[model samples]
Target: MNIYSWNVNGIRAIQKKGFVEWVLKEDPDILCVQETKAQIEQLEEKLTQIDGYKSYFFSAEKKGYSGVAVYTKIEPLNIRNMDIKEFDFEGRYMELEYKDFNLINCYFPNSQSEGKRLDYKLRFNTAIMKRCNELVDLGKNIILCGDLNVAHREIDLTNPKKNEKNPGYLPEERDWMTKFLECGYIDTFRYLQPEETKYSWWSYRFKSREKNIGWRIDYHIVNESFVNNIEDAVILNDVMGSDHCPVVLRVSVE
Candidate 1:
């Protein structure tokens, strides 16, 4: 199966940039989007009628804020807006259960400028991790993908020294990722292309994207039990709808 994740920045904006056309061309079995930044009512009517997929959207109560949506060729057996306490307000997670596994589309909190929201982000991460572990315990193979908003390692960004104290690069945020990995999740892209210095997110500041100075903050992480079934994981750095490019993963399943 071909599963893809992209932080569209804003669904409306990307629609104007030919997102629909791109979706048809890629033809993924499932596509998960984050940071939609629009309510369902505000979305164009055409968006609800994509040709071959069943689309599910979850928007924040607050207008024009964080949101996530998932479109799949195979309709989920069940779809749920995760009820994790303290983390539901932002509309950051959507969980879908297929016949064999669970797919989670996440838009993790960005700590924001001046480290102002770090505490909230940390707490949010902890809650989600707990929820994910519960699903793992249920014997469901999980595919958790999103813009996690952390650079993860020195190789994940262009200039590690300069970004050492930055919000997403901070030790606390990076360590949270370490904890996730320790809990039996595999960072699929890194597992497939360990030495490549590729990236998925670029700053709009100072022509960062044109210069290829970016960070690999987005990911496709799966439970370790499914690691051998992963066929390929990649960053579509050449895509141009948003500052963040799409990450794709292919898995084999009988």
Candidate 2:
């Protein structure tokens, strides 16, 4: 199955940029979306009603803020808005449970440029890791995808030396990622292409995208048990709409 994830920035804004048309063209078996920034009720019918997919959305209580959605060609056996009340308020987490495994779409909290939200972002990383571990303990294979909001290594960002103190590249955040991965989740892209230096999110300033000075914050992470099932992991750098691009994971579950 081909599963893709993108942080669309704003669902409404991207819809105007032909997001629906793009979806139809790519036609992933499942498309997990993050940063939707709109409630289902606020969306126009055309935005919600793509022809061949079942769409599910979770919106933040705050209007035009953080949110997520999933458009799947295969209907899931069950879909859940995560039960973590603290983090769920922002609509940052959702999961689709299928016959073989669970696919989690998450939009991790960004540690603001000023570092004011750094603590919160770290807590979120810890919490989400715990949640994933719980599922793994139950023997459920997982595919976790979204903008994780951190650059775990020097290779993940364009200029690691300059970004060392940056919120997304802070030592603490990177360490947290190390701990998380040690818990048996594989960074699919790195697993497939360890020396690759591509990125997923680019700064909207200084012609960052054009120069390709970006960070690999978005990911398609899979539980170690399913690592052998992944056929390919890729960054769709050519696509545009959000500051982030889509990361695709092709896996064999059948």
Candidate 3:
């Protein structure tokens, strides 16, 4: 099935910028959205018209803040909002359990402009990884997607040297990502296109998108067991609704 993920920045803003049309064109069987920044009530009228998909949204308690949503063609057996103690308050994770696997959409904490939130981000990462391991131990396949907000390697960002001290490229952040991958998860896109310099997120400043100076912070990571079934992993670099573009993965399942 074709599964896609995008951090829309703000669902309302993108919906005005033809996000609906873009979704129709892509025709993914499932779409996971991060940074929605709006509650279901606010998007009721606009998204209700989208056909052939069942939608589930988890909004932060704080208005206009972090949130996530999932739209799927196949009806999920169960949809759950992760209660990761401190992290769940921001509505960062939503999981859909199908007959064969669990699909998780997450909007990881951004360290913020001053790096004051780095500690919290790290803690969240640890907790989430633990949660993922718990699921994998159950022998169920896992598809984890969203704006992980960290550049895994120097190659994942435009200028690694200059960005060493940057929030997303900081050594601590990158190390956490390494730990995640080492825990038997496959970074799907990198697995398929290792030499490609493509990126999913761009800075809104300095004409980053125009120059293609960006970071590959978003991802679709699956457990190692499903690696052989991965058909294609792609970045929709041409599409624009937010500073981030969409990342997609197609995998085969019996």
Instruction: List TM-scores for all candidates, in order.
Output: 0.98, 0.98, 0.97
Whole-model lDDT per candidate: 0.92, 0.92, 0.90
Off by over 4 Å in 3: none
Clashing residue pairs, backbone N/CA/C < 3 A, model 1: none
Local error of candidate 1 at residue 62 (angstroms): 1.0
Residue 133 shift from truth in candidate 2, angstroms: 1.1
37-155: candidate 3 lDDT, tens digit per residue: 99788885657457878888899988899999988999999888776667779999999998777999999998876677999999989887887899999998899999999989878
In TM-score terms, candidate 3 sits at 0.97
Give me the overall lDDT of model 3: 0.90
- Model 2 over residues 11-31: C-alpha lDDT tens digits? 999999999999999999999
Cα lDDT tens digits for candidate 1, 122-172: 988897788789999999889999999999999999999999889899989
Error of 3 at 56 (Å): 0.4
